[model samples]
Target chain A: MAGHFKQKSKAKQDIPTASLPDIIFMLLIFFMVTTVLRETTVQVRTILPKAEALTKIDQKRLVTYLWIGPKKLPDNAIGETGVQIDDALVEDLSSVRSIMYRKLVEQPKLIVSLRVDGTSEMGILMDVQQELREAGTLRVNFSTKRDVVL
Target chain B: MPVIKKKERVEPFIPTASMADIAFLLLIFFLVTTTIDVDTGIGMVLPPKLEEDVIPPPIKERNVLKILVNEQGQVLLEDLPSAVGLVRDQVKKHVLNNGVDPRYAEATDKALVSIKTARETPYDAYIQVLDEVWMAYFEMWDSEARQLGYANYRDYVAVVGQDNPIREKIKAAISIAEPDAA
Candidate 1:
């Protein structure tokens, strides 16, 4: 009985944690290598409507821009009825469609941000939406000003 | 003496726990790295431009449908006060009778239609008209081939009418606008 107690061999128990950290590091590297980056390339020209609740977007290109102003004329913004692309006049909505398609094709994931005048007719805005869908550039955001909170 | 004393039982090593940890780590890694998209409500198609025989037609008022909506929300089909209920009927009639006028045919060749809207008219009216036009096109396409009136599938007016009458209607409706309305 005395020999049995004395013969007990307490083997060294130091399970290596180095292997775990090595694995965690490798996983971190793999994720960093495989991560995809998103770009912001606007498909249309839009002047976001003035809003009482607007916040500044951190970047461009992630957003598409559209400006709706006077249609058919030399471009009088005070009273306009059509869309603008990068500030140039688009006489008709079809122009908007084709241009958007081209942009969407180039940048597979681009969000369109609309800066619309509050007074713009809903019909025209809907028309813009209809065109966007046909072109497959669906991402949309509205530009607004931050309201003064009382 | 023969062989040896009974061999002690041998235990095989198992790595179940390690494999599970590795898998879980990989799963979390992928979930955090994917990109997502935002969507817009409407779609658009841009027209293709060609330089060849692109000619502007000598468009006159008779060939044009001339839809005008004044600031007061009165809808005008060809300069006449048109009600929302009357839009489909009037447009349908005009489209069906399109072949009656040669100039209406000619004006459409240039792809012009004058939708003159006042500064204050609601934009919804225009969208409604556009929606109707698309619906009418679908109807014309479906009815022309006798897909709806099949006996098992049979037809007498097979290919009698020309395709795209709506395009003609749009063209004719566009001519002769009040140039300054824009």
Candidate 2:
């Protein structure tokens, strides 16, 4: 009996790691499904205005972002304020209509999200609005941070 | 001669011992790269562009509450200077006048909160103003729903969702005018 007990104590106790790969695969699948790779790299800096009574857009696929603010590089010869569509800078405001019209045609239920800087000139913002109106994408969302205290 | 013996080859197996490490690496990469920003904003439907400027129909003077945000970031209520903090209360009072005074909105249904922003006005100020107006309407609905036996605003909304007649009627009263080119 003493010899049997000594032999049992000498035997190595190994943790079961055979299912580790399977567990890892499950986690990988979960992350792949949930992770949304950022579609476009932001070329401009922006500080969204703060507000209350904000409504969130439920469907990510149905929204298009329009970033209007000073150029990310202030030292550039062109003025600081500029309109950026996706990753490219929009030089002419008039062209905004055609570009947005094409997007609207592509997705009829498209909701344009305006991510304008807090201190940006409203003239450019309004101009963008007029172009959106002409494009017939009348649904606009002025993206803002929630003012919790107020 | 003795029968020649054939050599049997052992099948090679791929090592998957580090599979968890690979998956963890990828998961950490995605975790670092992902930005879970939930988009929220004030939604507005703009009128279609016309070939010529069309003037809005005249609203009763009492029913209209004109809020102006100027280039200097100053807020004006009815062309008189006003602070941003008091806007919600002022709007609520006018909206809930309940036909008690001729100088205010004749009824909740008739109230119109018109917001006009200057071209140079800071975007922050403009959003703040709109937020206050929307808050006023929401507060009114909360109290009104409470009177109807609903516990609170959220409860009332849960009972009668956004598409109900009451919400539609109230939404019609809030209008945003074209921004002034100041």
Candidate 3:
């Protein structure tokens, strides 16, 4: 019995690391498949408002983002409200129609997600909406965080 | 040395000991950078641009439930001074009235909840009001789903899809009235 116990312990002492590579490779493949690299660095301060009526946009490819918020200044101070589409801040509001129209031409089923700051006034958002209407890309999403229940 | 040393045989084997180490390195890199946060928000389809000469189909006064948000974030439900919290119940009552009250909608399909906001109104306030209206519609759908022996509207939608008649029955007809040009 003592000899048998000794043999059992010896066999179990090495945790059998031969399959470690396979396991690790499996995990690596999973991470690689699921990885979505951050594309653009946002320049505005967009603190999205919290709400309950939230829907998940499963098809990430069909959605385009429109960031609206106060511009981040050099001295950590926020400047006037600005609208950003992908990389560049839209200098002229009228240009929004052309840019969105080009995007609509590319992806007909484009859903424009408005990531607006909570404190932003309705004026800028309305202007953006007008441009979107002109561009004929009418599907809009008001991006908001899930409101935590107490 | 006597008979050519019998031509010494050496077995060849590939080294796999470092394979796990390399995989672990890559795994750690991805683990550090992967962000699985999903994008969640309220989805709305904006009305298409109407032609200059085309006049929109006129909706009856009773069919529309107008909720206006002023610059002060104060809500005006049906042109009456009201709090934001009351919009949900008022919307539900208006939609489900079914011709019972002359001031409310004639039917569920005819009911249109229009949210009009002033240019100076905070975005959050508009969102709050919109959220309430959406919640009211969701609650109605939930009850409708329960009556159909389903768990909730989502479950029912999963089974029947978006184009089903039930969804068309209690369709959420919300209109975002454009603010006056500044």
TM-score of chain B of each: 0.48, 0.81, 0.86
Compare the candidates by TM-score and give the number of the best one: 3
Q: For each candidate, report its DockQ versus the true two-chain complex.
A: 0.07, 0.65, 0.75
Q: By the TM-score metric, which is better: model 2 or model 3?
A: 3
lDDT of 1 by residue, B1-182 (tens): 33333333445567555764675577476657644333222222223232458864455555455566666657777666777557555554555554565534223243234456664565444444543443443344444334545322113223333333433433322221222335
**Candidate 1 per-residue C-alpha lDDT over A12-78 given as tens digits, one digit per residue, 9 for 90 to 100:** 5678664675676577667666555443333333333322212244445566677664443235334
lDDT tens readout by residue for model 2, B1-182: 23333323445678878877888888787777665677999887877776677765777888988888899878999878999888898898888787887767888888888888877888878888888888887787777777778887678778778676557556546666765423
For model 3, residues B1-182, the per-residue Cα lDDT tens digits are 84555545445578989989999999999998887888999999998887989988988999999999999999999889999889999999999999999999999999999999998899999999999999999899899999999999899989998787677888899999965522
Report the C-alpha displacement of residue B97, candidate 3, in angstroms.
0.4
Which regions of candidate 1 fall more than 4 Å away from where they truly are? A1-119, A122-150, B1-55, B98-113, B145-182
The better-scoring model by lDDT among 1 and 3 is 3
Clashes of each: 51, 0, 0
Place model 2 in a CAPRI quality band. Answer: medium
DockQ leader: 3
Candidate 2's residue-wise lDDT over A1-150, tens digit each?
Answer: 999999999988997888987887787777778788877876666889888788889888899999988777656433488788888889999999999999999999999999998888777888899899999999989999887872
Q: Is candidate 2 or candidate 3 better by DockQ?
A: 3
Residue pairs in candidate 3 whose N, alpha carbon or C atoms collide under 3 angstroms: none
Q: Candidate 2's chain A scores what TM-score?
A: 0.82
- Sorted into a CAPRI-style docking class, model 1 comes out as incorrect
